[model samples]
Target: MIRSGQRSWLGWLLSLGLVWFGSVTEATAQAVPQPHVKAELIAETTAIRPGTPVWVAIRLELEEHWHTYWRNPGDSGQPTSVKWTLPPGFTADDIQWPIPKRIEVSGLVGYGYETEALHLVRITPPADLPVGKPVTLAGKVKWLVCKEECIPGEAELKLVLPVTGDVPPPSTWTEAFSRARAQLPLATSEWKLGATVEGDAVVLLLSPPTPTEELTEASFFPFEELVIEGAEPQKLTRVKGGYVLRMTRSKVAENPPTRLAGVVVTPQGWRGAGTEPGLTVDVPVEPPTAFGDALTPTAGTTASKPSGGQPLGWMGLWLTLGGAFLGGLILNLMPCVLPVLSIKVLGFVEQSRAGRGQAWQHGLVFTAGVVLSFWALAGVLLALRAGGQQLGWGFQLQEPAFVAFLVAVLFVFGLVLFGVFEVGVGLTTVGGTAMNRAGLAGSFFTGVLATVVATPCTAPFMGSALGVALAQPTAIALLIFTALAIGMAAPYLVLAAAPQLLRFVPKPGPWMESFKQFMGFLLMGSVVWLLWVLGLEVGVDGLALMLGVIVLIGLGGWIWGRWGSYTYPALTRRIALATAGIIIVGSSVWGVSAIHQLPPVASAAATQPEAKSGSIRWEPFSPARVTELRRAGKPVFVDFTAAWCLSCKANERVALETAEVRAEIERRGIVMVKADWTNRDENITRALADFGRSGVPLYVFYPPNGNEPKVLPEVLTPGIVLEAFRETS
Candidate 1:
């Protein structure tokens, strides 16, 4: 284990602060707080002839287990990123990613590898090459690396190469460099890469198949970001010797570039990397008609704007409101909302019995709170956007502080549900039994609380609505916001307006206590989820502190609960309150200080490969290796999943455990590897991201070379699980 030594007292103080302030919110937050990546430029060719391409690469080596992300970092984690500064005449081509193995950890999936992976770039020598001089290439590299907690790392890397004739690179460093170059993805063998000028957009075509052409599983990774949404790639169908990949180009470009870069992975475990050759109408190249009918540019012209703008209209307003409203309503059901909702619900039930008039009044106040909170959120988002920030809705949760606050709120609410605390008389008036449980204030607050939780989930109607609303004028934006408030508050308002609805609810009795307790259990589960999220954000140490905080709270509660037994009730109450308050404050302070006491932020490194490290041996996923083992006749089970997706968790719980699946693996000496994709891991992300996916649920089985590896469906069944393993065996 690497131990952090205390050097500067100030640094140590900051480390403590990190520990204390780090919360569950920080745990699963996607972006790293401080990027820690370092980059250097290495070139084999000092100078090259004009019109000829030379090999130049920006080699980034992450510290230890911390890994930079790939262009497509599976479902989670930021991709390792770079922006190159080149001279006017010179331009750099896309960096090529080596084939990556899938890594699975906990229940989440990620795409990255331990140790090192290099990104190679092909540079086109300037046509007007200046002799005897070198040009400088500079780049700013920023990346997020995560082992458990993620930190952002960045560096400025520069390199200068001398100009020379078209002689082959020197043999001294040539072999090593050539080997690295060969490791890059190869273009399709059977498929000739080329672009066709369709009516409006240019369609790139892939021709020629590998030696083995029966493609049961295959996908492509576009060279450019934003060109592809990283959605699942369309299926590959065999046509004679080659297979055609049906994919849509990005909405940015009108005509295809001179070259398109991509990676193609087949069942053979073969990765092909090459540029899609351009189609010259003069060469009699056949235009592809099968790839989904050529996309028609919106304006009937091929020119695509860098920033795609939406068509103006009221539809945008409607979309925003509809999304917000639906999102708000759905928030009532999120785990994070349950504890707060329970408190509001119970208070309402009590208030209803007291009087209908008071209940209605309470409801309106709560509604105001909910609407105001949403508007506040909208204002913040708008402000950020106006300031040129790149963010989307739900960005607040990306902060560890926000997550910590939510976690605390939920924990306290959970305690309240368990009867550890209660709102005093002033606050109680709104929801007490004397007022009747559905007090207007309590109900309204519930609506507001629901909206807060609703921020996380984008409901069915929310996407298009929010998308449209976000693109609208400021006046229109507020109008949509109002519509959303109306939608979200409608259900609560209806219940408040119709006291008859109260009559429909069965009279509360002993079941009330049991229900409250059940909700408490649900709240506890939410805490567990939050803890996991926290683990992802700040590492395990922060989680330990959180656990400590919970324990401290529990102790304080215990003290408070028993304090009323003293003869002097007033004095006892005062002492108990003081003691509890002190404990809460002390714990919070200590926790915050402790967290911040660690080291200066460093990016998280990818865990070392199990096989090489000898920690826990997991064979890398390779077609040759799988074939060799199978011919020796062993079962091979490849888990192609990542760490950020939730569906991957459920499948692991329900499907991986069935007796049959375990028996096959153990009995047949099956090779199993769990690809983890939680943080920004380049290798694994490139692997999965290359396949046109951002999340997990991928499983593959390789029997022998004769029989191609079977691609399992996203959702797993007991039979599906058993059958795949059996085939491999």
Candidate 2:
């Protein structure tokens, strides 16, 4: 958001040095300050031991809300660095950092400290006899702290301590060092970690030696840039025996790194009692598999010949058809589909007085609409996958533009439900297209809307069925999609075919109007959720513009209802109609322009709420760690999930998040790792293929004594989970 004119001089000044040696004005034996922060040099020991390393530090205490950066400043900004000016035979080690926090501003993420940050360094002295002699450790410290604007700061500091043969009492800052040490990440062989390339993602695999305390915060700060996309989402997914954090690959990074290093920080204690908050990560990265080779079936995979060109046995095809059908049947109940379907069905209720033939007509048209829409989406999926895009089910909603369009669509519908405007001969559809026909147009559009919104969820049978469908020939995939469509549309078809069901429906009267308005409020609630999702994808600016578009849509609806409704003169109605069109279309164009095609800027992942009391804390999945744990006689459970997957979220709430489940897992000493696939993840996609699934919620459990990993059911319950563990035992 910084304009070209703003902070041009700051960039020039940054060129001066990483350790910007500002002219000194010492307060107490050498400490300096300016605008927003105070910088100083401090020591850990009152007296230094000769022939050994002594601890010294550069401390910066900033004014409230202004802050500096970590070694890796993330998407934007420079790190606080120091230039040592020590006497001969003196050596300074690299700064030993305490864990830095995740800082977010204007949709950018950075790893840094707030309120205060103390960076420690070791100053080593050569072996020599110099008793009772004072030595000064001179250094220049430079940093950049930012709020609305960034300010460059520095100070030359000299810490004088007496050299002695005997150990000296701890300095005044002993307690401070102790506190910061608790936050520092230490190397641990207890964890077995590695990394792999999954198309545009770099997944860091982390495995703990044993079950860990609940990890309320799991943010990874890469030691170096170009190894991973720092600004994009680092999805933490659970897998059998370990955890995987899927990071978007940096666009500028063309080659895979031999070693990707960083720190994984947990504020509320990632590990169990009496453990450090920060854990070091230095792992080797795996190269990517060739594209267009997905689901080719590896040695360990169950499905050997699953591709679009090859035909499955008739039995397998039938099973796939059945599964697809059932998946669609369940899809109607998903969170995304209900709002649209609810209003559509209410329209059917209003048609109770209409003849059964008319009702039957509406039903058939609605079913046709659903079936055709499915076919279209299936075609797009097939063509794209054929063209070598690693997309899976529910891919349509992944686009921020599509989600924004849905928000606009739903907002206008809510307005209509509130009687803002009704689509008649005078005005157009909420999408801004004229609807010349009657009830049939409403029915068909309802079916289409249902299909569009249903793309963000994956039902039980849908994942595997979709896997098989996409791997089959184009015709076969279309047929499978048809089955799914019919399944979803079955209930409406049945109701329309049997007018007797209408008898159960309430009589349409004043109450129906109130109910319709109430459904409007519910649709508005859905709009709120969609808006939040959009904001995460496009940032606050994009979100604000989208809100403005929604406002325009509301205005258009009012204008149409006020002046273009049946009560207005023809010429007046025409002018209002044209004016509404301009407002809606213009605002929509303006809003969409705000969508940034570039990857997310320097913004950390939003702070997730701490796990509820008695909940299990899961770790990052590391295959090597899982193997080690198994060898040592331990069990691991992993859940492959995504942010957009409603079924995944539902499972977490219903089966996994309960206190009983946590207790049982704890009793069994099971380690849990989550492999999140909310975004496009090639590794997760391939992992799904290894299990013959194309989507989540996949569950795999690794029990002790080298038992084979047990793949649990897509849907879960406490008894079911307990029984799985028992069987493995």
Candidate 3:
């Protein structure tokens, strides 16, 4: 059945089929498609000459709507990386990243390239021999591609090129390389740029080489994390010398940076002839100046002075100082300070009965006490701020230990006012012999106590003045604080100076005792409020510790009042005093330590509140959440509040918690965010600074269109809140 010629032809056909099948299988194995992206190593030219530098790129083609990250992947994401396997004498430089587009996903901001990107690197070969030899360039590239979700991919890419003595022919990828080159950021001396920090924003001033149109669309991509809040919309406005871009500073950027390095991208038509559109900038960050100085000098024209120089202009400095004085005068009427001032008033009444000269001396001593306390507080605040702390006025009230101590002190004051013991014999006197040194010391201590208790109240004009004072140079800041001290003491000083004013006061009588007892009740009420604030800060455990301390304090006061002042034996009295002092000191120490050691409240537990009808449920505020809501085109309302701030509590009860406001907010579908600053929250502090405020009770309204947030007044009424929604709508 097998003829010789036929059998040979059949064998040859079978061998041909086997060869073709093997060739096809090898080709398929060499070209496997990677998930989410296609990656390859490409050269700009088909051939390279010896000693000449050649541009090689790792090109990534992503699926639709997918992207890969830049070197600095903003809020989140990892950048694409590559490792090359080069020939013996070849060297490769770092990969150059092109300008990245700002990509926002679920409120998180990222910098990356969509669809496709070319990461270029330059390679150089040694001048020695092998001109006719072909070289293989290989690299292992890894990248993260993300759409709604993220997928990681890796591929080994290889390219072959011939080495020659003549100039190489351009490859088909030449156009791709040219386009990538155009996207690269240019660094040149022609463009003048500068940056300065103002309040919580970093102001960037850009002066192009030639005149250009008002840049409506521009963005700055920082090289480091936590230098700027990437999600917060940047405000760009045209100034005299250049454009000023005001971007919110990151909460994590505690220390002011000396230099700011980033990429600045403008619209396509912004570039002048022969100038690059995008700039890679590394400019020095100028130190912050006073609000007054910022208004006078044009940014980017001249450099700001160093630290020691005065930053505030004359007009702003005087106006802020005047406001501080007026605010301090008004602080006397706040509920928190009223009880303490009552004791000072009683002392003034007693001194006035003695003589006008003695009353005036008491007033001067009290003024000295207030001024010294304010100066010390100002110094500490400045030092802490310089050391990179995001602190503001009333920061001390946020501390549970401090609040507890104030409560204990106020409680003891209440006991004194109740006449449980004689003023001079058992405790510091308020109405002792007016001309004695002891009486003067009591007057000074009263002034100090008043200053300490007044921290939680922010009177009208006080917030803006304190904010400006804190933002200025140290000397100017101290001057403003001094003015506040004088204003607080002025009322008492004038009353003492004009003895004729005392005619209006009733003569000393039995009714004064009832009034003193009533003031004691007021002080006790303040103590209760402080206890509530402590509970909010450290939870149930801290409340228990504070209550136990109060009980111990009461026991100690009883011991001192009963036996410590007088007894048959001097040794018995001394023992009783010692025991009382030990109990008071030990209980205070234990309470403070226990409160400080309490664990932080879980964020989820703190944010969740019981559901209620006709009430707006508030979500805890975070930078990411704000960004997300804004990106979703939803309007947002933010309440920056602290439990220690009486004004904050009043506003919440009177305005925010009202049914009318809630109904309106719900009808508008507004996203309500509560930034609780009851404790030390740096994020909330930074947020307050963004509105040029230094304390709590800040209300911010963000429109659906992502425009600048509208900051409401410190005092909010239901009508005021409803009007804001209507205007924005």
- lDDT per residue, candidate 2, 1-729, as tens digits? 777766786555543321121111112345577678887888776666778888877888889999899999987888999999987788999998888876667767777889888998988887883765667788888889998689888888887666666665466677888887888897874666777776777766666667542221256788897777655645544454355566777888777667778987654354554678678988776653422222121211233223112355577799989999899888877665765755665655654645677668878888998999888888887898665566677677666777777887788778877888776521112222222356577778778888877755767787778877776778888988898999989988888888777787676567866777787888898788788767766678777878888988889888988898768889999999899878877777666655635243211112332344677676644344544566567787878776556667778888988878888898898887766565455555656655666667788877775656788877788787888888997
The model with the greater TM-score, 1 or 2, is 2
Model 3, 1-729: lDDT tens digits are 989999999767754544444333323323326887888777787676889999989888888899999989988898999888988898899999898887777768889999898999999988884865667778888888888798888898877676766666666678999999888888764657888887788888866576544343467888888888887767555444545677889878678667889887764423553345578879888764522222222111121111112255566688888998988887776555754756776765666575888778878988898999888878888898766687877888877788888888888788778876444721344554445777778778888888877756677677777766776778888998898888888898887677667776677778777877877887788888889888888787889888999999888878878886664479978887788889877888877877878865533215575446666788888765776677688899988877777777788888889989989988899988888787887666755654556776678888787555677877779999999988877
**TM-score, one value per model:** 0.44, 0.55, 0.59
User: Per-residue lDDT tens digits of candidate 1, residues 254-365?
Assistant: 5444454555544243333233221111112235553332221110011111111223334434455666677556545433354355556665565445446655665576
* Maximum-lDDT candidate: 3
lDDT of each: 0.52, 0.70, 0.74
Candidate 2 minimal-lDDT segment of 10 residues: 18-27
Q: Which ten residues in a row have the lowest lDDT in candidate 3?
A: 299-308
Over 4 Å off, model 3: 1-244, 247-310, 338-341, 351-354, 423-429, 433-435, 567-569, 602-605, 609-611
Give the Å error, residue 680, model 3.
0.6
Q: Model 3: how far is 213 from its true place, Å?
A: 32
